[model samples]
Target: MRHRAIQILFCLSVLATFAAAQTVVEGSVRDTSGNPVSGAELSLHHTPGNTVQSTHSAANGTFRFSGTEAGTYTLTAAAPGFFSSVHNFVLRPREPLALTIELQRQERVSEQVEVHATYQTIDPEKTGSSYTFTREDLERLPDPLLESSNDLVTNLMPGASDSHDNFLAIRGTEFSLHEFINGVSFLDNAQPQFNPGVSPQIFETVDLMTGGFTPEYGNRFGGVLDITTRSGADLGGHGDVNFRGATLDNYDINADYGGQAGALGYYLFVDGFTSGRYLDPPEPRELYDFGKGARAAAQLDWKWGSKDAVKLLLMGGGTSFQQPNITDDQLVGRDAQRHLRQETGILTWLHTFSSETLLATSVYARDGSDRVLPTTDPITPYSFASRAPFTLGVKSDLSRYWHGHFFKAGMDLVRLRELESFFFDSRGDPDVFPAFSGGLKGGQASFYVQDHFSPLPNLTADLGARYDYFDFIDTAVQLSPRVGLAYHIKKTKSVIHAAYNRYFSPPPIEYSLLASFIGHNAVDPSQRVGDVRAYTQNYFEAGWAQELRPQISLELNAYLHTGHNSFENHEISISRIFVPINFHTARSNGAELVLNLKQWDRLGITGRFQYAVARTYFYGPITGGFAGDEPLAAGERIIPAFDQTHTGTAQ
Candidate 1:
């Protein structure tokens, strides 16, 4: 009877785990001697595919994480002077027993090796007009705005404004895309659209790939951002607290750490934020934008049987954003209130087979919803929201550090559980507010292979291609080829660099839905004109990098770009939706000048000046497709959206 009762209770606890409405995970890290070590970078990978979070250790050498969903994961940490520590861990409703770490530092008593050898880290001045900002910079610097990474990075650009107080445009480009965690794609692909929705507490380093990019990158027509997250071990029990307020109160607390030399190591973290109340002057009425959110991510690593290491990670979070109602009589076309809520969960496992190769697989889910009270006269739904586009993928990497050629080969299998876009409704039909759904079950798949060949000490070349298979198209393949050459003027601390490449982008799903709602009048929309063909862009850049001194530098780049399959609004249709009928070829040329002055510690300035001319030739309206070859009836060239004739930025 006793044994039977015990089994019954165990079953009950397992079932209760899922109903907790929340999950909790906790662990720690240490050195081989079982002592706390700070500044270790840690990354949490969830199951299926989305990135959960990454963080670094605090002064106390400790950490803690909570509010997690049940799943699998792998945690990895490595420091410049220490050996790598990889851990695997799991989670439930409540199953964490204070973990510890005992790391083994590489005992190298011989010739020293400098680990930071990247182009920007080794010498910022040699790169001309760029400056790298570690997390430490954001800690000491003061930002007048709140919860905006884009607003901050752009201000640091070579030719940005001292403050983005208004709708500021750079050089002629109205929007700039910033990548998250080293991803090639910006979090929100649509430029100039924002709400300061991201929280910066969960990041590592933000690299500003402003210009002179190699062949690996595609089109944004402006700059590239490469972000690397913190994936090191906790090494000790330490955490931190940061808070800032504008119209309300914002508070946050974070803790995480790892275990000792034992076969099992662990890490955990938890954070949250809430706001106060305020008002807007437009309505001359009281307003309140209240937001509350929380997150927890943790991991454990298990290495057994000598050569095998398995890592487990569990992550989950919830957030809520709301606003008070606005009265119709008090304003024009806007909303009275808005509410947004999202819940996320992730789990992952990474098994390492050898020193030169590893396989990582993960799964992640996001349940996001929104509500709004816009005017009844609006054509679209009063509230815009989506719970689709859930992501899933698998990634693997093979690397070999040989004598003359350093090689790394990897591939990512990505897709969406829902349609590429679930917000579209054709036939001028009304949106099913609060019930937004994407009709796509299979979106797109991307595959690529790249090689880095260095024939000399200061010169490097690369070649690669990305093939994408989308929902509406048969197959889209982009051949990306690029080369870079740099020369260092021996002892003068100056370098010159030149690069050339091409980029491609297909019309996204949102444009398709606009077509569905096509009407007979000027506002008519359709499902994308004649299954539009592929679009391509060519890029060319040449620049010089000069380091006058340790704290000062300058860079100048001249560029030219030409595009194929350019889509524009068809003159025959006054509709805001799409009609793929109107098409054109484009040409853009520009030059940028960047200057840096960090010569004086604690007091420095950086800025840039840009000049570009954008023009497109739209073939006249479609007549069996050949008619588009003629110029538009209006005869005036259309200016590129990114074109900003004379623009400047400073920081």
Candidate 2:
């Protein structure tokens, strides 16, 4: 009967262990003589988050850390008559680990030992293929074009193709497709051109993910550009200023000020620049075109307590430029000048409910406007258009760990408004073409949940799904699933990773409005075009990374993406107005190889090579298959104008 009762109690305890939400870490501390070191001070440090927990050893040299999250941590022990020691370890979700540490006597003759602690929260596991750049890295890169811009950094990366002047095409896909600032969409007005308005002087770090992105990021088929700005806490209570000038009569000025007092901190940044066009021109014309822009940002941070914090950010910028209209390799009398402005405000709150649970919430709004003014030359036929796009959004995310599984769930809601107008001619004549103007208001919502499961010490799997809904599209709900696997070979310090994901990109709100205008003349609103749908793609990727030596590494990856129902502009009867239509399907495939070597930290060398193939097919002539081809047919394939077969870069 006694043995049976003991067995029943053991079963009950095992069941309770699986039901618990928190985890614990316990260990013992001993001196050089293998004796219990009671009252020794121990500190636990959580990387990236910088949260700290401390306790003293018990009378039996045992220490217990209860209610702690699963993550990478650094533990340190310090006591009198002994040298301090540090250890780095990973805590698995809901798993208890026991460890022992032995301290040496201070009197032992020894030399100083240097220890380096690096916090790499961006890619802790090194399972993804990406490149990270800091503010200093951006300044040292060679520039033959004599331009200081973000594009310079991306164009040099492996697998990057840039045939166009400003756009960056990766793996044969569209350029500048996805951009994020602090995990939120930053560039919404991407049609005609896409440019990140933030200045590099204020950027703390930039990460480019070419493959193996997490499920939390969606809505783009290409790569992702993640940018994080600097905070006032980084500078403590100081200010900085910088100025750069080149031979092309170009000049730039940037300034910043930041400081902290008590529990509050503040930061401010401003930049202004002018790129003189006369120094370098495509052609020698009597006329000239120049570029000018300015950017400014401010931030405030507040710490309520050990478990709560708040951050507020404000940013605004404007860009203006002029381009000469060229016909038959000659300058035309009429030129085009454009001005664009963007502003954004955001507030974020972070609270730690417990060691095993953390919550983050944010509210943000952004606005963008554009104006185009052309020379009023009667002979030249010019178009005038103006637009104002606004977005208001709210987001909330919750993270928890349980039973060796890390879970995250989040949702976002956004409202959009676009006020726009356009005309065929800007010669101050109404007879040329009647102006078309309208407004659109809509909203979008998304929810996602992801789990990072570790079934073995060397293997990890990430599985997740996301659902998106836009009120303006015919396909109201779209679902996307993502999965990735990673394995670490302990002996070789190498990693092998693979992933498969489904991607969806809803047509831009501005373009959707253009499609709705197809029925502007119809008396009944229900008769308007109703067949419009969002784009979808399936992506497959596999890669391997290994460090050949202490300062040299190599990486190779291959990817393929197949997409359908892609959106494009099709002219109607050669009229001035163009309507958007989903008229084509495409396939893009590519492979990349990169070799990096760092010798002595003062000089670095990098080489990249890539090969890509892209082809598009149209179903029918109504979808603008081919205009003047003699063999025009219902189903035909052709290469896009932007597609490039092979590209390479070395630096």
Candidate 3:
């Protein structure tokens, strides 16, 4: 009886071992003629445990490492009368992977063998109109003067207007360009005031999503610019310094350093510039406008292991500009001066459990202050005194990915505080004008999820949705849904894509808070109105990309933007007070055509053409009562501000 009981216990232990979950690495060995190579020996070694699993390919050229644990591994395959080969692969829990190994007949037995690992592209699964430029492309620009700052954006993107300096208008929308550095956004109210920005040389790549963006992005309705800074990889150390000089007594200096030490890596970039008046002056003078600024950014990264990392990023900058308000080609003592200073920082932690699973978390903060002294009013003559429009904010985001699905959710909490002391009297009392002082504190929280799936050989689909809640002038909540599909033609290397997205954005805190000052401190009610909430837009896009030749390609895209709850500020009687209103139903339709040519014997060319028509129908107290117009004659439909019919660029 004792012997029989021991036998039963041993049998149970054997069955349990086989029933447990295990990692399986399976593959086949083939010859140059695609014939199965039998009697092939394979060895797999786990990196962490240092354990080895061996197998032999069957006559059908099939082999597998079954019942093995999950870990990083090295696999070596050897067959008689063939060159030995090695491959490195990883296995995650409950995930099985397959591979194919091709072996060539050996001319001579050698000890040296080069092992190559498979790599994949980081392109987003979603389909949209997107363009990417790497460091190599930026360095190859024909003009050195256009290599710094955000100049490349205007030069390359269709529907981008360069009529104004350092400003871009995309798809008929002005003041709606949102910028993100390493997945963290720089918020803008009504204008692009995020100043003292980084130099382009400090970035590794710049990605622009023109339209039909996914739910992972928010806070902007027009476009998205995603900038990725350079990183110090496993390479020991590297750095570069660049300097340029141009006409009009303009000069710039840029320097950067990157290196890796043990488990830590670091990168730093510094830029400075000084320029004599470059823009054509409204009126000729000794000096019309000149400015200078300096910016610096640094990052430190620590690698906990092959799959986990932590990074710290810090940046700060300041700018000062002087403009002599000239009249009749003569200097005026009432010169205008403006100063801006900004600082930003972020800390991030990232971990990868397998090839298909990842988690990332980041916390960030920003502080900026703007001081403007406009030309003194001829009447008040007291410099029209007002000062210090300061901004500060803190935010955080969490990202997770599993298989082919991605998710991101975060909150952007901000505080906008300002002192409106612009009033000044002829008596020069400095406080003669009623002073209005206050601040606006609010934030937005959002959640989004996206999935990428391939249901057919040449077709892909992506679906996502986002929900947002804003705590501001008027409490509001919104839900947006986005979807895209792409089809590839393998024979021609072409792609057809279509996308639809619903987008929502709230007015800037500074702009939304102005509603409170309507009747406060003797303020005139005729100058302002109230009621602010989030803006919503619907985007539809379709595009086709074709490779005409080995070095050339062409793309054409068409899009329509239909939106309501548009934010517009109206001046009742040309007074300083502007009432904010969501007064327009806006519609814009556009098409873009782009041609690209790769470097052929030292020269590359790119050209783009765009055509768009944007219109807005305003219905409110002000629009209905224009004196020169008959009531309901045109139903309040008119061309809004910054509407351009045709825009193009070439380089």
TM-score per candidate: 0.60, 0.76, 0.72
Please, what are the lDDT tens digits per residue for candidate 3 over residues 45-66?
Answer: 6543344568789898977664
lDDT per residue (tens digit) for residues 1-651 in model 2: 112322432343334211111245667899868898988899988654354579899898988675554445788888776778776655543234445667776775474543333221222244456666544445455533214334444454556655422344566555334656555663262332323256655555556677766666657546665655566765668888878888645677888999888888899998887775522233455234567888889877777676676666778778776643345322445655667787776665666676556676666677777666655555555676667777776677676756556677888777777777766653453323345587777778989888876677777788889898877535467888888887877477577888888887766454345454542332233323344456687888888777665445567778877777554443322122234455346677777776655222445543333333333343332222112112224456655544666666665
Off by over 4 Å in 1: 1-132, 144-146, 157-198, 211-222, 231-235, 247-333, 336-373, 376-387, 417-438, 472-475, 509-512, 515-534, 565-583, 597-636, 640-643
* Full ranking by TM-score: 2, 3, 1
Task: Return the number of clashes found in candidate 2.
Answer: 0
User: Judged by lDDT against the true structure, how good is candidate 1?
Assistant: 0.41
Cα RMSD of predicted structure 3: 12.9
| Tens-digit lDDT string for candidate 1 (1-651) | 112322432343334211111122333556767676788776656543334556666555554443333334455666556766655443321112123444567778463533321112123112212345545444444543223455555455543321111222332222334343223232223221112233343333455555544322333334544443333243443455555545556554455454435666666656665654321222335444455666665555555563344444344455554433346422433333433333333333334344333333333333333333333434423333332234443333343333333244444444543332223222254322112233444444455554444466555444455455555332466655545555556466566766666665544332322222221112213221244444566767667767655546676766666666554322111111112332445565666666665334455543333333323233322211112223344334655433345555554
Task: Please list the C-alpha lDDT of all candidates, in the order they appear.
Answer: 0.41, 0.59, 0.57
